[model samples]
Target: MDGNRVATLVGFAATLVVLAGLVWVVGIDDTLAALTTADPVALAAVAGIALCWLVSWGLALWTVLRALGSPVSPHIAILVFVAAVFSNNVTPFGQAGGEPLSALLISTAADTEYETGLAAIASVDTVHFLPSVGYAIVGFTFVAAGAVQLTRNLAFAAAAVAVLALGIPVAAVLGWQHRYRIEAAVIRGFTPVVTTVARVVPRWSPPSAASIEARIERFFAAIDRIATDRRTVIQTFGLSAFGWACLAASLWTSLYAVGAPVPAEVVLLVVPVGSIASVVPLPGGSGAIETVLVTLLVSTAPVSAPVATSAVLIHRVGSYLLPTLVGGGVATALGVDHAASPET
Candidate 1:
């Protein structure tokens, strides 16, 4: 098997271990009982909304690509986006584990520069933070205006999200300002490893440091082009915000299905905060994101542990499992195995 398949297997194994531990902690009998009571209508709505979330993000990707002057058809954009999701779900470290394949797929689908494709996807992900924090702020306002009482734990989660929202933009700015230093560091760190691998493998040759630097420059240039397009930025942000709403709605519906409905405000606050946990070195943030979601639900609303656990499991059926299955099929159809580097 190739390295990507091996990493995917390892990630799946880790997720299974986490699932077993989670079931033990939450009590299998109670959770199973809760799951059995789920409302079919509400669960159906959750699935629909989850697909809508995928579509919204796909259009956002199209917008970013157009802004970069490397446009693909809407259908192609959605296909690439879903395939990218498959890569991410099966690998570790969220996008870091999946971007190379995503980039390659985008490049082939759009017939654009590989760096341009990477820039478009990266920009979409970066802009997603703005809307997430925007929704969180809206939820925070409801709490601040005495509309909803929040527990200390939920309040702290919102605060941490606030910090992250601020940190992302600041880090982006600093990274841009020191782009050359960053470029030098990456090349310095990567070149020797590439060289050693090429020497031992004998099948592939390593790229020179100069070529690596050139690719980095092209990547930055693509980012610059996308960043400068104000109209495209607004459109991408709007789509991202809508996507966030769909995701929030899916979670809320999942809870409703399990007879533990929370306020929409609570879902908005928790979904984005839970997403932040997804950056952990776990495939699709599998167990970690679910844990955060359940914890936040229990803390912020009138949700029992078993109900919350069931709700989250229902949510993942739509968000994680469904996407992985569909996206994996898309990836196979599009030959994404040939797209992502073997290092994945």
Candidate 2:
């Protein structure tokens, strides 16, 4: 294997070791005891919730592929997506590793270029991020309104701010597409910075003002095309919302399975916070996600320590394990040489 691949594997192994240590330190036996005591009906409910999440994610991927003007079969797309999930989960870089695997798999399966596959991936990610921001906005508003006591915990408030901060670029891109004049003003405001960066790069060639304007116009036009198509827009946003909701529900169901009666919204908030923490690029978010999730669950919900650990473990099994295994199997069966063909 190449150096990077070796490094990735090493990092992934290290992450697994850390997770093993965490489970041991936290008393895995106690966590298992909580799981053993969980109601059978609640366990079934958690399984159903996890199934819903997988279906929603598959649907979201299907919509994005369709939007890209590719007619790839949804079954194949979903299989590839699942495989990508596996790659991402076991790899060290979270979605970064997974996205490339996704792009490569889709490219190979559909006989497309890397760029085209990447474009499709990017489009889907845009759809996903928009709705996530919408949810975070709503969640933040609730917290701000004192409908939720999030502000009482500085860590939760900071997490909320971090999510909002991440959303700013996404909102800006959407705004630039929707409002041309405003976008132009913002771009103009950044011209000096852009120019300076261009100068610092030896091979950089700055675009002329007209060229820049043309590029911006094209970007806005593409966004308008996607945004104005009511069917496409609705399907994209609807699938994203459904996926995230199901993911949240899956966590809630896990807690229920552990006999913890936490509210669904609390689970929803915790899910996003954990996700945000996991963005730190560690394999499966390793220490970061577990720490944030345990902290949040302990502080925000009415649960014993064993229940909290079991709930997170169960949720991870559904969210990470099942999808990754499916994806990895699919990827193993597919030939890498198939990637060179153009998408039909």
Q: Residue 183 of model 1: what lDDT?
A: 99
Quantify all predictions' global Cα lDDT against the true fold: 0.84, 0.69
TM-score of 2: 0.75
Best by lDDT: 1
Off by over 4 Å in 2: 2-5, 137-154, 165-228, 336-344
Work out how many backbone clashes candidate 2 has: 5
Q: What local lDDT score does residue 17 receive in model 2, on the 0 to 100 scale?
A: 76
Query: Candidate 2, residues 1-344: lDDT per residue as tens digits?
Result: 59867877777777677667766777889878988887778767766777777677667767666765665787777776676677667666577656777777766766655555655565666677666666655554454454445435535745565655575576766765567677577578767777888989999887666666765665455455566677887897898788888877878888877778776656666776677655666765665676667767776666766778888878777787777677778887775445443556
What's the TM-score of every candidate structure?
0.92, 0.75
Report how far residue 76 has shifted in candidate 1, in Å.
Answer: 1.3
- The predictions' CA RMSDs to the true structure, in order, are 3.3, 6.4
